[model samples]
Target: QEAKLWLPSAVPSVSRLTVCSVPVVETEIKLRQYRCFESLASLRHYLSLWTRIVLAQRAKPRSHHWSTRSQKAFSSVRERADDTAERYRRDRQAILELRGRGDWEQRLQVLRNEDVLSADPGLL
Candidate 1:
């Protein structure tokens, strides 16, 4: 013979495959599947607690409670509130100024002179 090749006479067969469970990973998966709170009361309690915590953090929101995006969102909300307050102030001042004018002042005087208690509100 010029050449010869060696080969196994018997072939090995796999019987069973065993899967090991990781405790930490299994626990984490279970935790994710679990319900957040048992009852509505507990949910409400935690919400109130979180509200208090958030309120406490409002003064200086540089803590872990606030992320950069959340801080920016709160800042925008604050800015909108300030803008609304300023607008309301300006509107009230304008209304007051308008009421101090001739016809409006006369009408207010007439209403004041009349019996407000007995006066028909619809006509006024």
Candidate 2:
């Protein structure tokens, strides 16, 4: 079936080819050019087949093509998260150190008072 469909000589003469009883000149020209039994239908089928193959290959899980922009974005997000964690660690360490000091309570009281005065309109 496939072999017969692909053979140019299998197509009837131009005069005999018609679409809905109307003579199709362009289709006749294409049929003669390809020398195929069913020029338009065969070409359309082949095109669709190729398109599906390409799409399937692209959709495969392990066949991802990671672009540079996506890689850069991933690295940047990871770096930002690392930086935030490091900053938190450093801030926690400073607070722990301050808590261990002898005058920590006094300093804290003074800072609290200053903060309250700055935030309270009545104190000003």
lDDT of every predicted structure (CA atoms): 0.35, 0.36
Give lDDT tens digits, candidate 1, residues 59-92. 5667565666555654554454344334433433
User: What TM-score, over all chains together, does every model reach?
Assistant: 0.31, 0.29
Misplaced by over 4 Å in model 1 are: 1-53, 56-66, 101-124
- Kindly provide the TM-score of model 1 when superposed on the true structure, using C-alpha atoms: 0.31
Winning model by lDDT: 2
**Poorest lDDT segment (10 consecutive residues) of candidate 1:** 7-16
Error of 2 at 40 (Å): 64
Q: Please provide, for model 2 over 15-64, each residue's C-alpha lDDT reduced to its tens digit, 9 standing for 90 to 100.
A: 33332232344443343433322332343343344344334445653424
RMSD of each: 32.5, 36.3
Whose TM-score is greatest here? 1
Cα lDDT for residue 43, model 2? 32
